[model samples]
Target chain A: MDNPKHGMTLIVKTITRLTVGLILLFGIYIVSHGHVSPGGGFAGGVIIALSFIHILLAFGKEVALKRISYNVASFFESLGAIMFITLALLGIGSGYFLLNFISKGEPFRLFSSGLIPLYNVAISFKVGAGLFIIFVILVTFRLTKKDDRE
Target chain B: MLELQILLVFMIIGAIVAVKTKDLLSAVIAVGTVGLGLSVAFLILKAPDLAIAQLVVEILVVIILIRATIRKDLPFSTSGRWFFNTFVVFVFLIVFLIFGYICMKDLPKFGEPIMKVAQSFLNNGLKDTGATNLVSSIVLDYRAYDTLGEATILFTAVIGVLAVMRKVGRKK
Candidate 1:
């Protein structure tokens, strides 16, 4: 298991390579179309995080971390929260926090919702990165190797 | 309604199996089955958002639970106090029944929509928020402060996880 060059069996690797991209794309579709669809930021973000976890399970930590490291994920998690708060505070000038200030475009269109798409994007970033971070920490943390940590 | 009742029965059976199973992996999968039934029930009830969310969350939870249990030392020691355990269970059942009785007294009739809020939301949600989905608008626009609070709670939870999982908590 400590080969570090590969992970799992060849069959699992082949299947993961074929399906992981599709899962990520589907998550993006869900987030982008949240205002018109069943899924929104939280659900889409969980799907996105699951995609990364799939890679980790099939290809091991080295490859998965090479794709998106812990530091980068943590950075994006904080950045997402800041972005969401900034969007909310932008509404304060109108006597309300998180007030829909943008022009409500023609309904049912892709870009119709005033600030909903942006909020979805922000929340997706937060949830996806946070969940992935939690999974990585929980999976990688070793009780015996405390002193020789990464 | 028939389908829902069947699904509920399946969920109850799964829960029983989960509690009765000795193998940790089997127990986890049984619990996952219960969640899967719940997700299906949500879909049958016309709650696509909740169904989708529940399904995805159930998948993640099962994976995490399996990871937490597999290859770990098993501790199945019993205290040999069945009488006390039964007494506690009886007390819990009494409290649960009382709460259920109170809730049943206030529950509206089946198929009756709570028109107070739903009517207005359905009538004006699209015009007000310019979104095709009323649920999204309600969650992200009308009740955005609620969403913000939820986001904050998630952020705090992540921060706490990071803090507790840190390799070196003190500057040694």
Candidate 2:
């Protein structure tokens, strides 16, 4: 199979291969530890989305799209929003919206916060996929000249 | 305080560079420098969460802006009316200074709670939400409605962008 030249030079590709997984891992860490740490869902999700964008920037659209298609990203984005709303609605069982119903575990622990970690996860998914798809759409879109349109 | 002042100066300088530069790519980088300085200033102000968010968001913005500048055949020109632009800049600066002074007068002293609500949150946020980080507790548990609205807005924005960018919205 003949492979046409795509993406950046060798150095950028090499650096991207090495760093993308680490960036993704760090983003997950931020999201999971949101309750106990500085970074929460929003920041972590942005980082997660950036990782995918980094892949697209370094490896070109085809390879990046192969890994996570536009449809898959859109699905995850909606799924995240639905999961968050459902979590909020579930709080009604406790007599209030978004009320923490589960037992609050020991403070300062990883699994301590009731519903917070879950919220973080949902938000991360929503933001990450939403931003990724936005970047993909904006970058891949081709604008034809007025002459061509005419 | 001195460090923050220095950072603010650097940010101002970067903003000036961003405005003065003719090349779109250089301007983007200069703006990134300002954002980086602001992020560091956020860290100095002890808002680590904002700092992290600012840093990452700055990186992403720079990346996206650089991509946009590089890939397009943008017919950007900086030879516009200089006197009007300078007048506008001066007007903006004066207004900003007035607002800044007013805000500074009204703001509570640093590290002090200005509102009973803030004090209450500080005192009981951990106990109520079981999250050691007060910001997280408040954002997720206390102000979840706001977050829901924010998520909905993001969803709407994505859908709008998809609709506008799609090659075909309806079948012929």
Question: Which pairs of residues collide in candidate 2?
Answer: none
Give the C-alpha miss distance for residue A17 in model 1, angstroms.
1.2
lDDT of 2 at A114: 88
Candidates in order: C-alpha RMSD to true structure: 3.0, 3.0
Question: What is candidate 2's local distance difference test score?
Answer: 0.89
lDDT of 1 at A119: 96
User: In terms of docking quality, how is candidate 1 classified?
Assistant: high
Give the DockQ of candidate 2. Answer: 0.83
Return the TM-score for each candidate structure: 0.93, 0.90
Give lDDT tens digits, candidate 2, residues B1-172: 8888888999999999998777788899999999999999999988999999999999988977886777443566558897899899999999999999988978888667568788889998888888999999988988888889989899998989899888986453
C-alpha root-mean-square deviation, candidate 2: 3.0
lDDT of 1 by residue, A58-81 (tens): 999998999999899999898889
- Per-residue lDDT tens digits of candidate 1, residues B1-172? 8888889999999999999888889999999999999999999999999898899999999998988886763769777998899899989999999999999878888888568988888999999999998889999988888888988999898889889889886464
Off by over 4 Å in 1: A1-5, A145-150, B170-172
Q: Each predicted complex: what DockQ? A: 0.80, 0.83
